[model samples]
Target: MKEIVILGAGYAGLSALHVLQKSSADIHITLVDRNDYHYESTALHEVAAGTQSGEKISYPIMDVVNPKKTTFLQKTVEKINADEQSVLLTDGQSLNYDYLIVGLGFQSETFGIPGADVNALEMVDVKTAAKVYEHIEAQLKEYKTSKDEASLRIVVCGAGFTGIELVGSLVENTKHFAEIAGVKPEQIEIYNVEAADKILPMFSDKLGQYAINHFKKWGVKLMTGKMIKEVRPNEVVYQNGKDGDLESLHAKTIIWTTGVSGNKIVGESGFEERRGRVMVKPNLTDPTYDNVYILGDVAAVMDPASNRPYPTTAQIALKMGHYAGKDILNQMSGKASTPFSFKSLGSVASIGNTHALGLVGKAEMTAYPASVMKKVIADRSLLKTGGLKEVFAKGRFDFYH
Candidate 1:
């Protein structure tokens, strides 16, 4: 029997498992992850913002595992010895594989800013995301006794996709936070700090401005073009644009949503990588070893049109996962595997439960319509990974809200 070892129970890894479990290919699969549950990476912002519980976005890993053909291991991966076809676990066990799929997901990228990693809260996984809301609540609780206005201030360190959505979710929960602090909702100030003058550069100016208008309407202070210099305890230091004036914003809650890089294990395993991402071949295999597939955030597949790697998104990750499983099956059957290709349907950003903005194909979507599309896309992803069971259990059906 062939031994297939898949690492990380993320979107890419789980999607691969979903495909392989139904096949009678004389193969035994071992799925491994540090956590026993799989959460939607796209919905993490909601958890961090206290708009949704962590359980709402996550499901147990064993729920989708086909026990007859697949064994789930809840262990942390220390490193991968690609040349030896083995993976080392942090618990000091080594597992060998005939075919390996590496989809270890991503971590917060601090960009080497001083105190960013130490002081700023990172919402990379379910635990950390939950911690963010817990910390925010603690701050609010403290404000009731301390009466420190800083306890009500929230500073999100970046205005990227995740940061923007997080700001929206946080805004949605302002009343909840305000109730805890015994203050008016407007007293709980939220700020988004970004280095770029332009937000959502991937979308048109009109779409970006539409989001900005909502931020303004909702009382979210936008501090664009400010390069974050450092994150201190309850404060963020930044440089004011090209003029380079240093200023600091004090907040009780500081969220680091600046950016993310692939799992560090890829580089530690001797793969050629830049910022934890490997530029893989057209078939999504490691350039050095055909039997070793690297997908998700770790694999950098080039976009022929742009001559640059496509942005890492759950949409691309799912495609990569499905392609890897299919390609492996093809090779086992002595059939040629085809190069992977992807054309994005579009991208959408939800400001709050009821508001959103983006493009669907060539069509522009905004307001309630875009919000509905975002939920539909998320439900589609859940369907792909967790099937009908999870879609009904944890699906976003509150479209009217």
Candidate 2:
């Protein structure tokens, strides 16, 4: 049996393990992740919001790694030795592989702003979400005895889906926690700061406007067209782009969701990265080595239609994982497998409970229907990855119920 080691059991790595194991029963596989549980990263904001606990978003990685054909190792990968066909782990040990797959998730990028690293709460993974949840809970408690509500300000830096969605979710949770703590709803200021001309710059202008409208309706202060010059322990200084004005805002809480790059190990390793992602060939294998494959956030793939780098999404990551897994099987078995070409399904984001915006194919949706679909996607991910048994173990037998 051939040994194929997959690093990082994220969306891509896990999906690859599932697909390739089923694709070839003769191949032996081992999946590794730094953490023991696989986090549902798409729903991490909810976990941070106190709306959902972090446990709901994470499943044991070993339970999902098929035992018949695969092994699971909870260890952090130190470096990849492409020349030796082995990988170094943090435990002072190494594993040699006949084939390798890289699917490490994202790392927070502060864009070189001061104090950003020390102060900003990064919504990177489930653990970070738990930290955000705990921090918010602690802050709310601390504010209960305090008189200055203005000092309880929360500044969410970035207007992307993660940032916008977090603020949207955070507002309601803030309100809930505020009510519990006897604080006025209006007292908790949730400000969303964006450097771009508009929020959700990747979405259509209309969609962005809809999101902005929703934010305003939720009492979230929209600070658009502002660049973060510096992040202080007690304040966030910014250059407001309104009429070329410079302004600053003070906040006790700063959640930084500005940008993300591939995990540190990959970028610093021998892999060639164009934008914190390995440049993989059509078959989703790294250009540097035939035995090594790159998927998910670690791989930079071009959109054939536009020739631009595709935005990293879970849908693409899952598909890319399967592509790599099957292609590797094809290569090892001397069989034929098709190159990867992702078919865009659609995406939806929850603004708040029972409120969401969805773009499925050409149709656009907001409100209840979108929220329902969002639930479906979230539940389906757990079911698909861990099967109905694990889903039920999570108390999700009937998805809608």
Candidate 3:
């Protein structure tokens, strides 16, 4: 039997596994990941804000994969030998594969910022989000006892999707946190510092303006066109572009949501990578290694319309995974695989539990209606991956909460 090995069980890898398992029984499939569970990466911001528990955002890998067809190996991938068609594991085992899928996800990009790497807290994964949540709670407790204003001050770096989502969640949880800590809600200081001239640069200006207004009404301090110079333990130093003056905020919590790059393993494996992403052919296969497929954050696929690489998001990754599986099956059947194409349904960003901003097709929405749409999208994702059972168990049904 041919050995088909899939590395990393993120959205892309898991989606590929689902498709491949039902496609053919001629090959043996092995799914490898460091963790036994598949994390709902899109909801990591909620995890960091204590709005959702880690358990709520993740499910066992076995729950979604059929053991009869797929062998699940929980281990770390040490290295990939593309020429040899082998993958070395940290447990000192090397596995050979007839077909390989690389879906190893993203890593935080610090851009060589001073003290940002070591000092700022990251919201990249479940573990880091949990840490941030715990730290926030601890600081609240400390502030309650000592009344230290610095303990309540939080400076969030970046004004993009993740950063905005996190700040929105923080806004939602502030009242609860204040109640628990026996402090006034006004005691909490949340500042969103962005180096760009405006937030959500990827979205339309009208949508961006709506978010800005919502934040202003919600008491989130927006510091635009400010470059973060350094992140200290008790303070964040930044330079304002308007005045060219250095300013500082007394913040004990600095959450860095600035940027992300493809997994380093792509470049380390001797593949041609731009920004750590392997440029894949139209069929989502590596140019040098036809049997090797890269998807999600690790694969750089260009958009035909824009003539630029598509942004790495859960939505795009899901579609890529679906296409990658079909292409692999076609290759195995001695048929030419079709080029991958993506149709974007839309995009939505939740401001809080009760509010959101979205652009679906040409239609734009805000507040409660947008919030409902956000929940619908999340529920639909769970339905796609894990079916009705998983949806009932882990789906977001509380649209208003």
Candidate 4:
């Protein structure tokens, strides 16, 4: 049997596993991940803000594993020897594969910002996301005793998708935070700092304005056009406007949502990469190895229309995983594999559980309608990675109050 080794059990890896495990092909699958559970990276914002528990967004990797064709290994991948078609694990076990799928996900990128890694909390996975909430709660509880106003303040660095979503969740939980600190919800200040003048640049200006309006209504401080220069303990120093004057936002909770770099293993493996992302061929295979497929955040598939890589999202990752599976099977059957392609359905940003804004196809959505669509999109993602069982268990069906 051909040995197929899949690394990382995130959306892309699991999606590929789901497709491969169903087939009766003469292949044995090895699924490797450090964690035994697969969590929705998209919903990590909710986990960080205490709006959702870590368990709510994650499910066991074994739940979807078909033992007859697949074996799950909880091992951290150290490096990939593409020349030998082998992977070295941290535990000293080397996995040799006839075919390989690399879906190792992202890591926090500080872009060389001073003290960013040490000072700011990161919501990379279930544990880190949960740590954010733990830190937030601890700060709030500290405010009750220390009566420090900074304890009630939250500064989210970067107003990108994750930052905006996290800000929304934080705003949603402000009342609970206020109660803990013996203050009003309005007194819990939430700031979203972004260097870009236009936040959510992927969406239309109108949709972006819609989110900004709601944030303003919810008392969130939007610090657009301010570039974060450094993250200090209980403070975020930023460059203010054209003059480049450095200013600081002092808050007890500083969450880093600036951006992410792909897995370090990619670079360490000696594949030509930028920020841990490989520019794969049209078939989604490594340029140097036809049998090795790279997907998810670590793989950069260029969009010919814009001459830039498509934004790394769960949607594209799923498509890449599915396509990789089909292409592998085709190759096994002695057929020509097709090139991978993707067209986005749309994108949505939830301001809170009740408010959202985005475009669905060509249609614009806002408020309750957009919120419902957001839940539906999340449900679709759940259905894709975890199937009906997981959907029923962790699906977002909170459409109405």
Candidate 5:
């Protein structure tokens, strides 16, 4: 039997496994991951903001994987030896594969900023988000007696999708947290710092304006065109611009959602990578090694329409997984694989619990309808991954809130 090893149980890896399992061909599929549970990474921000529970964002790997055909190994990947077709696991075991799928996902990119890696709270995983939630709650509880405004000051780095969504959730939940802590809403301060001139730079001007307006109305301080110079336990230092003087913002909590790069293992494996991501061929396989496929945040594929690399999003990752599965099956069947052609499905971002912004096809949406669309997109993902049962168990059905 062919030994097919799939690494990392994120969106891409899991989707590939599901599609591959549908085939009747006899193959040994090993799904390896550091965590036994597959996490809804997109919902991690909600967990960090205390708007959702950790249990809601995660589900057991067995919930979706068919044990009869697939063997799930919970272990961390230490290295990938493409030349030998083997993967070194941290548990002192080595796994060999006839076909290898690397979807190891991402790591927080601090851009070499000092102290940012060590000090900033990242919204990368469920555990990290829970830590952030606990920290925020502890600070809120302490503020009840100490009345320290510093404890209430929150500085969120990056104004991209993840950063903005997190800021929105924090803004919406701050009122509720203050109420429970017997403090006024105005006592809380949230600063969204961005290096760009405006938030949501990749989006249309109207949508960006709408998000900016929402931040303004919600009392979220927008610090645009500010570059972070350093991060500290109690504050962050930033420069106004390229040649501007340095300034400082004191806060008890500093969230760094600035950026992400491919996991280091990809580069350490000796793949031609830029920014820790492998630039894969049109078929989503390594140019030199046809047996290895990369997807999600680890694979850098260019979009012919824009002549730029596709942004790392859950939607794109899901599509990549689907296509990668097909390609692998074709290879196994001795049929030529087709090139990957991505279709634009638009995008959505939650501004708050009840508010959101979206661009589906050519139409733009905001507020309640956008919020509903966001949840619909989320539910659709779960439905694809673990069927209707998973949707009912972990789906976001409370759209009106």
Candidate 6:
């Protein structure tokens, strides 16, 4: 049997593994990851806020792949020798493959902002969630004992989905948390800073405004069109359009959700691009080699309609992985392939627990109904990735109920 070696056990990697099992591709498959299980990146903000447990966002990768055809290797990929058609694992083991799939996801892009890397806590994965959880616990402790008002300020950087959801949960949970901690609501303040003029600019203008209003009602402050010039342990300095002078805000906790670049390996592998994305042909293979395929955040898949690369999202990655698997099997069997086409089902960025905004087809919804639809889509993805039984066994569908 031929070999299909996939890197990074993310949406794309896991999806490809599933298709191979269902098709009985009989391809000797080895799935590699640095972590023991897959972390749900989409719902991470809620994880950080303590609304959802960390385990809710992770799944055993082995459960999703057939052991007969697929094997999971827990190790970091040190490097790739594309010229030699081999991959070097961190433990000094090397494997050569007939076909390689790169689905390495993304890393946080600090955008060269000062003090971002060292000071602010980032909400990335389970580990990061734990870190944020610690910070929140520390804040609550300080508020309970400390006489200083300075310890109650929380700075949330970015108005994107992650930032919004994190702050939203902080708003909801912190209120309950404050009662438990015996701190007044006025004592805790949350501020969301955005470089862009608006929040969730990817969504419609109306939805963006709704988010802003809801955040205000929830007691989250807004700082728009401002560039954070500096970030210190106790202060965040920014410059707004109206005043050339810098505006400084004092905060004890700073959570960064500005954005992310592609995974490190994407560029390190000698595939050229910033943020770790490489543009590939319609079949999703590298330009220089037919044996290598890149998907997920690592691939700069072109959107024919917009003539831009597809945003790195779970929906596109899942579909891209399926298509890439079919394409690779065709190549191995000496069969022609239909070019990879992107079918954008839709997009929904959730706000806190019960509010969301998105566009699916020509229709859009706001508030509770939109949020319920988002949960439906999430449950369906879980079902497809795992199975109806697995999805039901976990019973996450009850999140909406």
lDDT of 6 by residue, 149-244 (tens): 556778889988778778877776777657645787766788898888888877888988888888878778898888888788878888976566
lDDT score of residue 128 within candidate 3: 95
lDDT (10s digit) by residue, model 4, range 21-64? 98889999999999999999999999999999999999999999
Which sections of candidate 6 miss by over 4 Å?
A: 399-401
TM-score of each: 0.99, 0.95, 0.97, 0.98, 0.98, 0.95
What ranking of all candidate models by TM-score puts the best one first? 1, 4, 5, 3, 6, 2
For candidate 1, the TM-score is 0.99
Comparing 1 with 5 on lDDT, the higher-scoring candidate is 1
lDDT of 5 by residue, 4-101 (tens): 89999999998899888887877889999999898988888999999999898788988878887899999999999999999999989999999899
Weakest ten-residue segment in model 1 by summed lDDT = 198-207
Q: Candidate 5, 159: how far from true, in Å?
A: 0.5
Clashing pairs in 3: none
**Model 6 lDDT vs. the true structure?**
0.81
The whole-model lDDT of each prediction reads 0.94, 0.81, 0.88, 0.93, 0.89, 0.81
Query: Each candidate: how many clashes?
Result: 0, 0, 0, 0, 0, 1
For model 2, state the Cα shift of residue 97 in Å: 0.5
Error of 3 at 276 (Å): 1.8
Return the clash pairs for model 5, or none.
none
lDDT of candidate 2 over 1-401, digit per residue (tens)? 89999999888888888888786457889888999988888888888878878787787887877788888888989999898999999998899999999998788898789889997888898888889878877776777777556456788899988888888788768667777557778778889988888888666887778788888787889988898888878578888785576677877678899989887777677788855788788888878798899888888889988798788988888888878888887887798757789877788877866677868776887777777877777777766667786667663223242
Assess candidate 3 and give its TM-score to the true structure.
Answer: 0.97
Give the root-mean-square deviation of each candidate in angstroms.
0.9, 2.0, 1.3, 0.9, 1.2, 1.7
